[model samples]
Target chain A: MQKIILNQTWKGMLMEVKRSSRTKTAVSVVVPFILLAVMIGYVFGPGSELISFGVVIPEISIEKVEFVDSEIIATVRNTGPIAVDIVMADINDRIYPAAIEPDKHLERFESAIVRIPFEWNEGEPYAVGLTIDDGTRFEKQVDVAAPSIQPTVEMITYFAIIGTYVGIIPVMIGLLWFPFISKLSRSKYKFFLALTVGLLLFLGISAAEEAIEISSENLSDVFNGVLLVATVAIVSFLALNFVGEKLKKRAGASKLAGPIAIALMIAIGIGLHNFGEGLAIGAAIVLGEAALGAFLIVGFALHNTTEGFAIAAPMARTKLMIGRLAAMGMIAGVPAIFGAWVGGFVYSPLAAVIFLAIGAGAIFQVIVTIMRWIQNEEGKLSNSSVLAGIAIGMIIMYITSILV
Target chain B: MLTGGQKMIIVITVVSLGFAGYLVFPAMDITAQEQPEVFVTHSGAVVQTTGDVLDPVYTIQEVEFDPEKYLREFDYGEVSQLEDGTTLREFTIIAEDDKIMEIAPGIFYNVWTFNGQVPGPTIRATEGDLVRIHFTNNGDKEHTIHFHGNHPAEMDGIFEIVGSNGGQFTYEFIAGPVGVHPYHCHVMPVEEHIGHGLYGVFIVDPKDARQQADEMVMMLNGFDTDFDGENNLYAANTIPYYYQHHPIQINTNELIRVYVVNMVGLDPINNFHLHGTLYKYYPTGTDMVPSEFTDMTTFSQSERGILEFEYEYTGRYMFHAHLTEFSEKGWSGVFYAKDNSQPNMEGYAYGS
Candidate 1:
């Protein structure tokens, strides 16, 4: 009976082991399936709702404010990625029935004029608020609401005067260093040429950087704005190179013509750079974003003086006629006037990108030309004086740029 | 003797394999199911199911849209007499690009629209009428109404980009060509404009009108909800499977005229097919005479035509893109034809 009990115990042990193994096998299969099912549910479930909340981002930029005969006219542009409907306009937190010229609806990059007959005082502070269809309000405050200046002859003259101070006068002042540069030795001449190279290089790099930033930030993607900047820069570089090469080949026989051609190229490059600066200043005034004080003008004047020095360095040894020098100065400065006119009257980001790109390309091509000329004069590059001149030139530009 | 570490490793390997098998096997099954299946119909024509369905993968409350209303709707514009004794049709179309619409079930898309709806409005006018479009762009992007017909350079819509945000442009021209054409935003990157639903049918009747029939507009359009350049969903108006769910009702033996416009972007070509009957097709509706009698027709983007047919037998008929992929992906619909002489027939109710 004891033997029989031992056999039954062995059989029971065997059955217990089999049952536990089956349970383990079943768990191994089912647990993974359950976990996977849960994962799938989490990933492809209503819980992961796409675009759950309707996102409405309304943005409007108040470009200009004007007071015209008991009426407050505010020019606004829709700067957001979405369309905005202007439903109401308020003056000093009080709602007013405003007439929106054209339409109340503004698509992205579209502008509208809002006219509110509020009889606002000229010297009093007033806040203008525009309510979009989404209930988001954009407010612009005029600390002293005054009659805004329209783009008239006086405005054009004002822009031209500012451009002269910023572009021409300071450049002419830098050209006063011409006599001193002309007295330098051949080695010193090479150093000054390298200095001009440094200055042009700095200008080229900064212009390219600004063009890239503006194209990416301000312009629409449909324009392929960044690519536009790159393509325009490349195209301009090739174009200027072509023009420079043609000039160099035409004047290859005359030693005087070489310096004059280089000076002309330098003037064109500086002019393009000055044009971009003028566009910025003009656009700022038009948008009422700039505080154009005496300090700002002086700072710009000081900054542009370096550009004149760069142009003068290339023409130091050349016997240039006064008419030619005057012409070169105008070439390097007069574009500012045209730029200001375009920017004030019809400012477009695409135009800004293209002009800046052209400036950068011309400046870079001038650097290449100057380097080749230096190589021809000095038999080799990388002297201590040349390096020091480049360093000093860059430092001067950096210091002046800070003031601006 | 096996170490404890080895036992643990074995257990982990077994579990991981089990998990992988569980996930991978189903994925393989789904991939297999995605293959198109061919099925021969009773009429001896082979039809294939593309296996592309409105697989939402998630459920949400459906957005309401009436395809029937849009199908037959035509905007004649405010009609008046011009100073030259010509009929003047003035249409004020508002363009908006910031409209979020639920294109498919639970699939919302930011669609650029005209007067708040996709495919805009069907603009109808008699040939030689002075058609003036007072276009206002209220959207946050540049837009312009470019009519696909004979007009002056300035009225061509290209180069005359109307600004966004309360920008206005008056497109005035004499309507001609005596057929159906598409009018859409002529903005650069035109595909994005038309793809987002900133397009509509412009139908100009001949000097002499044709026989009056049940006229309807069937614009074949697609939506790329993911912005991937490839279309994910397609439909006869804007909604997929809408007409299938609510079949278009018509009287038997009545002349049915369908003004079909294919504005499906991204895909190179699309086609239309009718089950149970053939119809007379007029390519672009330019010619007065029918081009052919066929059960199917092909179309490139912006291609349109007129299809005229009469039902002899009263029943439900299927109309869809002949391309199986498009039809499976929400481009399918049905037409319910009933004899008016038969009174109170069971299951003959509209949309039944």
Candidate 2:
């Protein structure tokens, strides 16, 4: 009886060991694969629920105007089943919160008005944007004019506004839900890693190209600027990662220490870069270059979409609850909103370079963390599927170029 | 892993396609042409004169060069029809003074002008008026007048085409089939020249309106001579230090017509303001003038108009270029109400 009991115990132990090994293998292979798939979906898949809108006005008028009161008013028409909220309105590089509560339902074609105070001086042009509760947005410009007491009325057609709203739907969806939906039915942590990698790779390559092509009266100076930005971004990213590894080994660091530190650093860098982009946008619209404005908007929107994922990915690593995760997702997108206002109002190319440098540094840091997280258990690193996911993400960017 | 050959092919395809797309999409930016550059006459750009009065550049007012009249007008009860590039009759303008006397030494006037006979003449035609103007550059300096609005490319009257000193060129054009038009000296910066006093008006009537109306024409231009021409000051050998200048003046309700022709070659988009009168049309050529008025109107580019108004009171009313600096310096004039008068004191003047 004693021998049989021992045999049974040994058999049970063997079964338990097998089950544990299987779980470990699954974690290593299947989890990463699923995450990779979600990253790919985010980049290439048709986005969910977000909408876009545009507004065209009499942007250039020599006729002077004297208004009793000047205010920015936006009337939103939600054509989808889901409610679209106005979270904030940005004007002249300043942001003001809108009166949109969470999860507000807006039925099709239902309109709501948002009003804000505005002071427009003659001969100085300005642009205003509305950021919806669902993360979608749109913009319009008030052209510069010489000051006069004469009253003039400018009109914006309803059809044009509606068309713009519809056009932005995909962009909104890509920004708000892609990260969350991508993690569904997979290892959320692994999925975030893949996304971080994708965004970092995209921004890094783009920045490198831009830095190389920097325009300046002195070629060497331009080259120096490019090199300096690259060096700083790369150095900071590596340095932060080294510090994070050291902290992970130390006692008493919080569970969130590594990712939190890395994310905040990256956010700082990206915020700086995005500010310059905002300035460029502002200057273009102010100068009455609508076409250039549109081009910048599209490019920045794409770049911003990737950044939204970058901020969310690190926070997600802590296995935060879903509601908390959604909040973090939005927090990451806040800089973009601020950046847009800045670009639309305070535009200077030199400022653009400085901000871009900061973003490059932050991105470098975040990407290094991502690389370390994905490294093999062995000292040597290898992840074919995640790399494949990157290729797929690039394809998505390619497809959007054609469609957009 | 994928074969090297396959990878090479994939890379080539992706790169080639991207290059193709880059080439294709930028074609959407369609506007890629060079705009004409502005040319100003350099050597004779300024006049050195010392005087108590501020020296000023010359100016032409819209009322004096009304460019917004239609080349042909429809009958009052008839609907206006649209027409383009139809050759019309020929006409001319002569620039002579009113008195026909050598009023003052070295000052000649009262000469028989071409169209109505004043500083220059008014030339009238329809939309596509292939009108030829024969001009005698009998002024102190080599001069040429280019019909500004509504003309064929060959008759653009660019400075390069303006003839050399003592030379002349015949300008031809289809009356601008659409809006008010502009005419000026295609030579050097004509602002100083016109400011020194040299210009006139040309009115192109739409074929549909009455051939002619009870019209009283006036020219609004500015000049700066050392002596006060307003008081007709006389100087023996030297030009007067500071005397009188024309502050372009006009009255309302008299069917007072204007065909402002600017000889100013430099200043673009002079603030053309009309006090107590709102222009009926604002256009490029005298082809599509709006029929009525509401308030102040603006003129842009090389444009002209035929505006009408009536003054409410009698006084030495002032009409000057609205370009504040230009007008204050000397580029303006004044008009007297037949019944309204101001005291012309010994050496004093009224109004800015």
Reference-based TM-score of each model: 0.42, 0.33
lDDT of each: 0.78, 0.43
Q: Which docking category, incorrect, acceptable, medium or high, applies to candidate 1?
A: incorrect
Evaluate model 2: give its lDDT: 0.43
TM-score for the A-chain in each candidate structure: 0.68, 0.47
Task: Give per-residue CA lDDT, model 2, range B1-352, as digits (tens).
Answer: 8887658757965874565343222112222223321111112232221111111112111212111122122112111233663454444433222323221212233322223222344444555455666554434344556665655666665553433333556665555453334444544555443433344455556667632333533333322222223212111001111122233233333444444433332345443455554545434334444555733333343345555556666544444446554443333334444432444332223322
Candidate 1 lDDT over A292-348, as tens digits, reads 634556676787778888888888888756677777888998887777776676566
Model 2 lDDT tens row, A1-404: 99999999998887879988778877998988899999877765687323333431111111111112344433333434444444344455334322221112333333344443345565676655544432233455556532222212221222122212222222234335444644654344554456557656666555545544432311223125566556545654554565555556662457766665555544554554454455455545545566876787676666565555565555554554555444443444445444444434333333344445556666666666656655632232345556655565556555654565
Segments in model 1 whose C-alpha atoms lie over 4 Å from true places: A1-96, A99-147, A208-232, A249-254, A283-291, A340-354, B1-352
Question: Each prediction's DockQ?
Answer: 0.01, 0.01
Name the candidate that leads on lDDT.
1
Residue A24 error, candidate 2, Å: 66
